[model samples]
Target: MTVSKEQIAAFYSTDTLAGDRMAGIDGLRHTGIATFMRCPHRTALKDVDIGILGVPYDGGLTTRTGARHGPREVRNQSSLIRRINVATGARPFEAARIADLGDVAFTEVFSPATALPEIEAHVRAITQGGVLPLLVGGDHSISYPSLRAVTENGAKPCALIHVDSHTDTWPVFQGSKFHHGSPFRLAVEDGLIDPKRTVQIGIRGGQNITDGLDYSRDSGMRVMMIEEFDDVGWKQAAAVAREVVGNEPVYLSFDIDALDPVFAPGTGTPEPGGITMREAQRFLRELQGLEFVGGDIVEVSPPFDSAGVTALNAATLLFEMLCLMTD
Candidate 1:
């Protein structure tokens, strides 16, 4: 029997234009409040594999204060995301129980001591529920507290894959020790990450001093500079990373400033010569089979973002992390 053209067209029809009851193909992308990839927003973390948490305090930023707005803007712009990884044939939403837990609240004015503890508690609950925290950051400092939450529960310190332009391993900046520049240093001090298993990739630009790089080396992290990264290429870099972080629970922290200013200009500390966004994507995709316990994409200062490129870079990087997690 031949199927009528009207019968085939009926499969695509929506019963109403109210946009309330539609699901599957009849649904619209921008029709509702934006969550991560339009996943359902749930207050509870029960039975979830991946939980998206946004940290909205940028008190730790040394240069610009706009990263506090990163969460809101990233969420607003993520309405454009769909659930599949087209390159790798990964269906992240299908592979895991994912939900957006919304943003963590902080004091009106930013305070690291106050906000860090709050962020830790929020992530602790997610980890307690056996959910992997896919955090969006207020700044790179947020990762330190976040690491505290995930590892503070008597779990062995995990391996870290830190992608950034700066080492962020300084013991302290000036007199203060709680800024974004000092997260991993504090993490190392707290024994929250095994520096032996840690690998920091794509570090570039000049610092006033080389103390941070020296510290990272002395602490046993594999620091791959931009020149070294380009010479070895993504495959060898990824291979070295995989070997260093082998079989351990891994926390992937991506700083948007790791990309050059041209591709991702909205970050607070962007360097001139860095990886391209596509290179970053391929580099991330190359490590698909690792054990990614929790991860974050940080320093997406939306106020500095022109053409929405930085936030978009962040959102897309979040997708890469999501794809890794699901893998």
Candidate 2:
């Protein structure tokens, strides 16, 4: 295909032509009201292939409170994103029936304990309605309920691709098992996630207890701690991830804490040495062909974020995941 100056000119001129399939009537990427990737903001999930849902409940945050604001900031920052994947040639919005389904509704928003079932119900509706959700964070705790919805309603337990600095497999936290530190553990116990088939990447930092670490090892999940990740590198680590998840329907859960403080400083629990944003993007891109039933980017505490660094990185990662979802 030869490049045409006329078509290129028209793309940036004013609006779009009738046959402009690339962006359709969405207008300029930076001009429109921002939804996730500027897809139409719709409340109904009917006939939608992918729903960009937001779980803006961070009641489980024992360290910091601002992750409750992640979804809004991510949505705002996503307006700067343009269609088409630079490396993989993926035009996600063009390829899928995607829309911003807005945030998940909860009856009592302040309590993480009360929020689990509501989040699960929201995800259950999305999954049952045949909509794959690309959720933005309230916090990592949302993963448990979301996974529960997927695994319980789908054909079987989901294989997880959890990218975080913490294993989050603790048996309990501060008298609550539903808190951020224990979602994966709860999921594993409830059979919502297949521990043997799961692969947790970018795990680093120290913890106060060995219970979670011990449980992760005993449960037989592939855990690539930061040092091991350094030895093998992200490419090989991604290959190992693919091998673990195999052909199962996978759920990708990313905590901003998985990123080094330099790349994403706004997370509730910041780890010293972790993957850079670029490496994270590259690794996520590597999962392009897998069966992604659902995914999320969590723990972006915009209140603590520096000059859009963390939120922008989160938005970009969401874009990468969106490309894979389209694939």
Candidate 3:
């Protein structure tokens, strides 16, 4: 009773076991470390054994609307969309060797003052290892620490490409300079980032008062208001980003609020009439050739999310950013 070649092949394939099915801390990767620490239960579902970390602390949020749950939700939804890049045929994790390094160790429960330094330390360690860090958010404030880590040890200054609803250049808010609205300001002041080569895109909303406009101009950061993007188109915006960042290492920070509230209603601050997902993808895709060192997708609050739309969007953007880095 010998089996035919086709039958044998099928039997062997079916009998042979695939890779390990068990999930554990060993198999997971660490990018959203801070978020995982905030909610271990949610982290376990999204990360833990699944190779993702959720940093769910939104201490820097100005709206104080509780976006700390973003990391876990985004990870849980982002996992479903995983696939090999059709053009490159490379899985993002394999291409970049990204791991869920776990979250930053925060000493204080709700203090950006303490959390920022911790985040910096974690990012510095990851960067030092030559592995790119894809941070999930507590808020945009996390970017300052992540940038500091990248620039520390006298690493050459990197350009910043910020996609957000606001310029995030306010000097201070609510007697705290470390709020989410001021990371770019702090990063520039600390000389960790190259302001001359920095660009902020998708900036809209009422926060752009006289002082905000003046500060953006005075600091040498390029601002592409959302309205300006509609007029010039995404190709032109990408061109400006490339021209500003040039060949230097660039960090991309994406705030989900950059999208219209209809698409990303879960964000701490919802801004209407924002860029569409298609427009956002077009803008990000144009940076295919730029040197991206590190990046993040932040500000998705699950409590406010109705059908996990914002988390899915954030996850997709994170994956796209990872794809961009590979190029």
Residue 265's lDDT within candidate 3 is: 92
The true-structure Cα RMSD of candidate 3 reads: 7.0
Best by lDDT: 2
Can you write out model 2's per-residue Cα lDDT over 1-327, one digit (the tens) per residue?
586999788768866322223234545556645577666777777868998898898988879789989988998887777777788899888898888888887888767667888998998898889999878988889998898888874347889999999999987668878778888898888888889999899887787888888898899999999888888887998999999999999999999899999999988999898898888988988898999989889999999999878988999999899899999
Q: List, residue by residue over 1-327, the lDDT tens digit for candidate 3.
A: 676999877756763211212112332333332222112222122222222334567888877466788876875665444445554454654444344555556777567777778888777766765566778886788888888988883366789999899888887778889878888888888887888898988888987455665777788989999999889988899999999899998888999999999889998888998998888887888888787778888889888997989998898787678778766
Residue 103 in candidate 3, Cα distance off native in Å: 2.2
lDDT accuracy of residue 243 in candidate 1: 94
What's each prediction's TM-score?
A: 0.90, 0.91, 0.82
Roughly what TM-score does model 1 have, to 2 decimal places?
0.90
Q: What overall lDDT goes with each candidate model?
A: 0.84, 0.85, 0.74
Note the residue pairs that clash in candidate 2.
Answer: none
Q: After TM-score superposition, what is the CA distance of residue 293 in candidate 1 from its true location, in Å?
A: 1.4
Q: Of 2 and 3, which scores higher on TM-score?
A: 2
- How does model 1 fare in lDDT? 0.84
lDDT of 1 at 320: 85
Candidate 1, poorest ten consecutive residues by summed lDDT: 17-26
Better of 1 and 3 by TM-score: 1
